[model samples]
Target: MSTDHGDRPVTGVRLQKVLAGAGVASRRVIEQYIVEGRIRVNGAVVTELGTRIDPEHDLVDVDGTAVQLDAGKRYVMLNKPTGVVSSMKDERGRPDLRRFTREWPERLYNVGRLDADTSGLLLLTNDGDLAHVLAHPSFGVTKVYIAKVDGRVSPQTIAALTRGITLEDGPIAADKARLRDSSHGSSLVELTLHSGRNRIVRRMMAAVGHPVTELVRRQFGPLRLGTLPSGHARELGKIELGALLTLARRDSPAEATPGEAREKTRDHGQHDDQENG
Candidate 1:
């Protein structure tokens, strides 16, 4: 048993059992990780196999990556189709996220937005702390987009995207850009960036004289939009959820403890920059 700050009794399961139950690994493997000091509760590494934790409250990390101990939390990936809005409800009567999310019992909200005209991977979740961290551009969760542009994109154009260009908002650069293919007066280009600026990819391509004709976000952080048909949504697999949690933990500042992170998320529920191209 563990006690809260007020000294109230709180029942907790053993650390190894919790990790094993979350599918991090088998109990024996978790024990090995605990023995090797590769696990942390809250922010401190715990090597004792007998340690117990309040699963609903305490944060756990394995090999420095956060683990989602709260099984009730839902992590969903929706390959949003063009013309559907990102909002759960659209007063304007436009098609919205509710179409895809209504099936879940928990009220899941999108971690970020994609322009109605754009389509790709969008994370919908009930985990507010993870959503806040992933949606905030300052945390540097990279997004990759494959774009079909109006003009043939050259190596110089790719170079320029990475070298940085001055958008109306400010100067920005793709962490990486490459021309995937070029033919018949149009080109396929892939760009990776961490920016959450509105219609950023379209603007960036237009800036380089190759306006985007079509765009699809192929990846968001560690999650990939792979073979899920357009407009379809699916619950994240355990491995996928693990990767997302790990990325969120990695991007969050070291000093921000789990309790502080949750409190901050609740205090500023609307703080995440949900908008993106």
Candidate 2:
């Protein structure tokens, strides 16, 4: 299981990370299992957090059950449907994403989560490293959503949302927002933001007096929901994968995209101009 260079384990990744990505358990739970003498990597019990294993070549088992790993990492886009939880298992007995993963014997976990009521564009992967970067708020991977709200969203309300609104948690705003459509007292609005705050979009809309009735994630970073049927999944293409990783490698959230740089600079320049005025 050790792919080494000159007797030093140089390839693969931390054992707990690999196990967690394989959907065996959470990293903390896996660490406890390691100490309890239940996890074996290539027939050797692993207790050290530093232990590395080639997920491609490592044979891992827990409590006599084989922990399967893919020969290569898998990345898939799921157009999650409302009412289905975005997890491998749902304790409440609701439908979960495990149905999609049943085709692949290897384990995979959701990159983040899509609240059961707010569906679309969920990433599922067995690559823990990629998952960590995309999910970490420091990377600021942008997510786009379409919301159907309870009232006609005015330009002033939209401006307030763009300028930022204070919710119960804190002030949060969309990087971009516009009314997509309005009909029968319901308004359709699109929002783009990088903050991963739980239910940020719904809360923001509500704060602006336009409570959202339905929400769907349209894009996650570089990946789009695009015609993918609800409750179905598709493997990410190489080009899409490259773009996603590029976003993940940003030095900081502010540097994620060229357009973002201009926006940040404008925010600073606007303040300076106001002071001079």
Candidate 3:
């Protein structure tokens, strides 16, 4: 059995570090607050860099408000509708995601992006660390999209997509691709990709024969679109969160240890069932 060290001396941590650890803001932003005299320690404004404090003992405040050291992070999935821009702001005064999230208590930003004409599952979070992880390409989070193409896609075009196609940016390949449905002249196809390039799905299809007339993301890693109504937002449940964390951890450069690998294997089976069901 491993021995636990119950009594350990506290270590001094940088004031900015503590604020960042609490998810208040990034370390650089905290420094800006310090330089702006917006940060205080023990009721005295501290404008000095390299200021250190013991989180358990120090009384820290920002802008005259006591800093809560343990703020719970939040993750939300929003079904973004067409016509709303994905960005935080637009000079043209077009509708944006903020209109939908203005009622939320926490400030959140979009994870990845969907074009203004596209619609589907979009992630919003106040947890910067988690957002950074999910947005990083190295994490290899798969985004599954259902694309409605302008024309029928032949088997040869699908094969080219799976084999990888050359675009103006570079060579790109879909992890998985299959025709969801084909009727009349238009076709619906599902494409899964790990890369988050700008307008990747549409460009990839266009590189072949079928240009996408419409696109909607159906899944992101373990999170599925589910029958959740369009233009609605919901928080991810604990089970879904756990599964996504596991998937993210697996895709991390820090390869899963044997124990983690086994856990992921079991979780993968359940995730597949849930996603397909």
Better by lDDT, candidate 3 or 2: 2
Predicted candidate 1 versus true structure: per-residue lDDT over 165-266, tens digit per residue = 998899999999998999999999999999888889999999999988888999998899999999999999977887888777767855545565566544
The residue-level lDDT of candidate 2 at 270 comes to 18
The 0-to-1 C-alpha lDDT of every candidate, in the order given, reads 0.83, 0.73, 0.72
Off by over 4 Å in 3: 1-71, 253-277
- In the predicted model 3, the residue pairs found to clash are none
Model 1 clash pairs?
none
Q: How accurate is candidate 1 locally (lDDT)?
A: 0.83
List, residue by residue over 1-277, the lDDT tens digit for candidate 2.
4433465536678888887886768999988997888987866787666677877656677765555456377778988889877667666798888888777766777777777788888888766555655554566678899999998989998888889888887778789999999889999999998887777887788878888899999998889999999888988875676566555543334423434433433122112111000
What is the C-alpha lDDT profile of model 3 across 1-277, one tens digit per residue?
0112346443577888889987668999999998999987866788876677866556676765555454465667888888877766656898877776776798767776777788998877665444555655456678899999988888888888999999998999999999888899999999988886778888898888788888888898889989878888988775666566455544555433334443433222112111110
- Extract clashing residue pairs from model 2: none
Candidate achieving higher lDDT, 1 or 2: 1
What is the Cα-based lDDT of residue 272 in candidate 1? Answer: 49
Q: Native-vs-model 2 lDDT? A: 0.73
TM-score-based ranking: 1, 3, 2
lDDT of the structure predicted as candidate 3? 0.72
Poorest 10 consecutive residues by lDDT, candidate 1: 265-274
